[model samples]
Target: MSDYLSNPLELFSVAGKVAVVTGASGAFGEVAAEVLAAAGAKLVLAAGKKAELAAIAEKCRARGAEVAEVNVRPTSEAVCDELVRTAVATFGRVDILVVASGKNDVAKIVDMAPERFLDVMDANVTQSWLVARAFTKQLLAQGGGGKIVLMSSARGLLGHPAGYTAYCASKSAVDGITKALGCELGTQGITVNAIAPTVFRSPLTAWMFEENDNATAVRKGFLGRVPVGRLGEPQDLAGPLLFLASAASDFYTGHVLYADGGYTAG
Candidate 1:
């Protein structure tokens, strides 16, 4: 409405915005941090691994972005709250939150102990909820609209034949939270959305990218379902992430932007 028609690229500019990225040590977390950093955002990165967190912070700093590192997981409400405080203390305000701190425990429902299932839920579902809760409180207090970009997976929409019982269940819960929060914060000008990628080049899935016979067979089998005829790369996620984190997606919320290569289409 303000008329940026002359330079539409402004829609994606996150210059000087403050962002909080959890799971800063993980695959998607690194992508989120680097993307936000390259897009000119001040960063507050959190993770359980101090060395990894510091590495991410250093990369962002190298990009000329101010970064605050917190070597802790958002496992509890108190820790989540403190993370928000750190953002404000370092950057004055928070504008975006990327909940990337989650894990997958691959075990069939029959073989997985109840404790294992519960642990996966706590890591994926409970932690995401806590971080979102803390970030939302800060956004409301700051009296401005914000963005909450949640990390989901193709497993959220499609069931896997392998041992993905816990992983699938957890991501489905993430989708629910994204929708619920989007509705609740709509009036407040905040947007909530998720990025669901099937499989990308990450440490956990690195074997699928190898040139060995096992990797080749597995890759071919998987690609049979992917209409795009290729596995996902990290850059495949960057655009969608930028869109959700910037003004380009101001009118969009409660949506899941699938970065999969059409794997979920069928």
Candidate 2:
């Protein structure tokens, strides 16, 4: 047996692999890129903001990872195709893909506008599908097994009393995509999975933990439902991202790994 099979730690090594991370400018994407880079993977980072993508590329480079930055709307199929081509041209191949780009619009069903709901769906669901499809094409062409990690949310699996009509619907769609793709792609040596997280401390969710009466009440209410009694941190997702990106999760597909603090379990 190879050292990787004998030494389990070796299975988690993503050294020398090339990873393409979408939503690289977002809070979760930034952390995911850092974790992959820290594991010795070369990175192709994509986001709608050029400046933010550039900044993230710099950080990854500082970690000794060869990095490329792509500024493109991941929702565009043409743009997503270009992203895959760019990764291949820069790093020779794409071994892993992380679709961390998403959007959430909080509005009650009665108050939500149809356009806004569709926009949320386009951003969270359609964009992810386009990006994943683009990369999967490259992986199939290259004839090697690959890894795809989609970002789902705890909201995808469970509904909330709060205004979450658009957000919840979009993410639920993402969960379906993950499972369907995982089943369809398994035969090609590709594994598709998702990470579903509960309320985490990201820039997008910072308000909930801020110092204020409402924030305090929100925190208390959220924590009451969580068995772990604590919100998630960016670093908390690093290990999970690495595991799904590496060979450690070779046999796992069509799986939604919840990183929630027992919120889903409860």
Candidate 3:
């Protein structure tokens, strides 16, 4: 056997790598951390809730990966800077960063309060930008390339049928940010990408399933419209996240990958 072929296991591996995931206490963030751990990454779990972050860190530890936790609003530039410091201090380097903290509130543009609109924008877009900037800076300073993953949604691509003016605006802003930054930083070897998921079971989507009538209608609507006849799970984020974290997507940047159940096709 050739020496190169003998090391085939090196590809698709994250051994000795460190990843920082924001919103690690949330369903999606927790799954992302666990999956990365399974793939051989030390994890730095960032979230606003202290208790929940600790819990998830323990879970990642149980999976045979090192883990640390940081509490931050995620939207604040100062907080994002601190998160990078925390990750570097924990593992000595940050190989990947996932900006996954987000919120969805119903606020029609005509009737929405200014503060509410600002809240959605700050949480969904501004925070992602802050995190991305801080991590990219760290990577440059460390003299190594890095991967950045932004959490966007299908709503960012299409208009909402109901009242989602603020949420939609925030997500669309994220798509723009991802593309713009990816172009600016591509030459620096920092690949930026966004994941657009369909209706997934999370706190952001809980309202759609509330009340039997609303829930049934939403389910049926998705079933009829989407080619894939099922809702997405937290694990749905695993593979794409890994690809972005690894060398597989080295030539890719500024792309919006739809992890939807073909919801965007029609």
Candidate 4:
């Protein structure tokens, strides 16, 4: 993992490469992009809000990355196409794609509004597919293969007591896409993978952790038993992120690496 000259394999260093990350405005995403930038990547950050993305880009630029912007609207074609095009125009090549766009709503299936379910699915799963399609084409043109990471959830792997039907189904779709994409792109030197996390301490997850009488009350005993004895941290995910983004994972495709601190062990 050393980028030091003393270690020859350090060529795996992401220096000078370009990485395109979706959902760049969010906490987990900003952290991930910072990690990549520190390790030497020219970042192309895409998020919904222009001002938020401008801030993320400013930080990455300070770290020496060339930046670009894309809104996550109309995922079917426009945004994804624009994302790939923007990166290529700015950095001249695409080396990594991190599909971190997501949406979630906890409601019983019976009560989940049709619009809400569709919105979550489009954001979580459909956007990923659209972006992958764009990234793959550019990766093929670059001709050395590419690394793709999809953001999924532990909810996709297990049943939850809460009404997470829509969220769970969307995440499960991410897993399936990773598998199908791995097969379809493997022959072209593209590796596709998914990361399923459990309750990471990010803006997306902080709401649930805020002590609510009814919620935290029901989970008082369970909190004491998390095997890791601590909530998931952004730093805790860096190692695996690096692995999947570098040549170290060249042979790994269609795999979902769980970083849930034993949430699925039992």
Which of the numbered candidates is closest to the native, going by highest lDDT? 1
Comparing 3 and 4 on TM-score, the stronger one: 3
**lDDT scores of the candidates, listed in order:** 0.94, 0.92, 0.85, 0.81
TM-score of every candidate relative to the true structure: 0.99, 0.97, 0.92, 0.90
Candidate 4 lDDT by residue in tens digits, 1-266:
45555775664577777899998888767876887888888888888888888888788878876667675642768667877888888888899988777888889888988999998998888888898888888898888588999998788888777888888999999999999999989988889998888777786567556679765754455556468755688887787777888877888999988888887775
Predictions ranked by TM-score, top down? 1, 2, 3, 4
Tens-place lDDT digits, model 2, residues 1-266: 46665688989999999999999999889999999988999999999899999999999999999998888779788999999999999989999999989888888889988999999999999999999999999999999599999999999989888788888888899999999999999999999999999888888799987999999998998899999888999987998899999988999998999999898997
What pairs collide in candidate 2? none
Model 3, TM vs. native: 0.92
Candidate 4 backbone clash number? 0
Clashing pairs in 1: none
**lDDT for each residue of candidate 1 in 6-47, tens digit (9 for 90 to 100):** 999999999999999999999999999999999999999999
Q: lDDT tens string, model 3, 162-265? A: 77988888989999998998999888898999888887777767876676987889788777878878788777788888888887787899988998988899
Off by over 4 Å in 2: 1-5
